[model samples]
Target: MNYTELKARHRSERENYASNALSLRLHRALSWLNKAEQVEDDDSKFIFLWIAFNSAYAQESGQKHYDTERERYIAFIERLVSLDSEKKLYNLVWSQYSSNIRSILNNQFILADYWRFQSGDIKENAWIEAKNKAMKAAHTALAHNDTTTVLSIILSRLYVLRNQIMHGGATYGSGANRQQLADCSALMFDIVPLFIELMMAGQHQVWGDAAYPLIEH
Candidate 1:
């Protein structure tokens, strides 16, 4: 569902059933998703969309040690995919964004290891071999109808792009990586909404407490 429909549905049905944690997550994520829809600049749009994704998946950790942000989100994706009996996510991965996903996977410029090696941080060009392996694995997963694996790999690539923009690694409005930014932003436009929808549908599952939930003083 689009942002409008999703917002209405949340008010009419989901808000009543959502746990305190899920309610906070959906509200924060949906607000960002709506903001992204009004944005025209690809760079800004991508940033807003990524915030929505982060809002949807971020959780509070009471322990001193916890899963890395990457691991947590990957696990979140696995759960969402498992709950998707309608195969909405599978269809989106296999049919809607396959070519764009391939483009992202093949772009070594976005890979952190590629830059690390170039900067003399590492002696070997291991990222090349790693990238190649990831590409092959992604293609194989696609062929085998393994949507979970495909989505995970695609998310990893997108995470790299996100870091580049958010961490001041990329120039604003530069032509160098315009295509990559556009492609990533477009895919996020679809994926973030679907994620929020799936979270609402699967509210019965434990999503953990949201980080920094609202509290009345």
Candidate 2:
């Protein structure tokens, strides 16, 4: 196909996928979580919570390189921060979920041995320490294919938490697991938007430079 035709196709596909699939799924997941919170039955709440968590996990970490590619995802995150540094939406998300992210980092039960290994006796900011450990784990995983190290990363934390709950590691009424689920839901709500924005930016960079630009909206 010609460049013009190819670009148009790309735009059409991206718009359809974003609107039809990504946005729809995200909306449904969030809606489910909202409804789930209202229920008094712990089993029902846990089931719906797991649905939301799995939805976010699939979108965020289902990519091929997400688990294996250290530098690529790190660079993507860095670029996202740089691009949206002054944007109010980004700042708002950060303000709301920054503590939630830290909580995920500090959760020993969810992280298990990975937590014991990385947290150590250091007394640093939880968020900073978590970020460092995740990055280091990513690097190690990419280099050595270490499952434990890979599981220590942020994406892995999200995935593992979902797995643990979905696979019966934690009971429905468990206070600790429920808190972790809530935190994951909040973190996903913030981080998913950033991931979508980064993806759009990457596509724009590619097609824009080729003289067939993507629509910003």
- The best candidate by lDDT is 1
| Model 2 poorest 10 in a row by lDDT | 206-215
lDDT tens per residue, model 2, 99-175: 76557756665664554455584434664566567656555544563332332355456666766766777776677
Tens digit per residue, CA lDDT, model 1, 8-28: 888877656647788788889
Error of 1 at 116 (Å): 2.1
- What is the overall TM-score of model 2 with all chains considered together? 0.44
Worst window of 10 by summed lDDT in candidate 1: 61-70
Clashing pairs in 2: none
lDDT score of model 1? Answer: 0.84
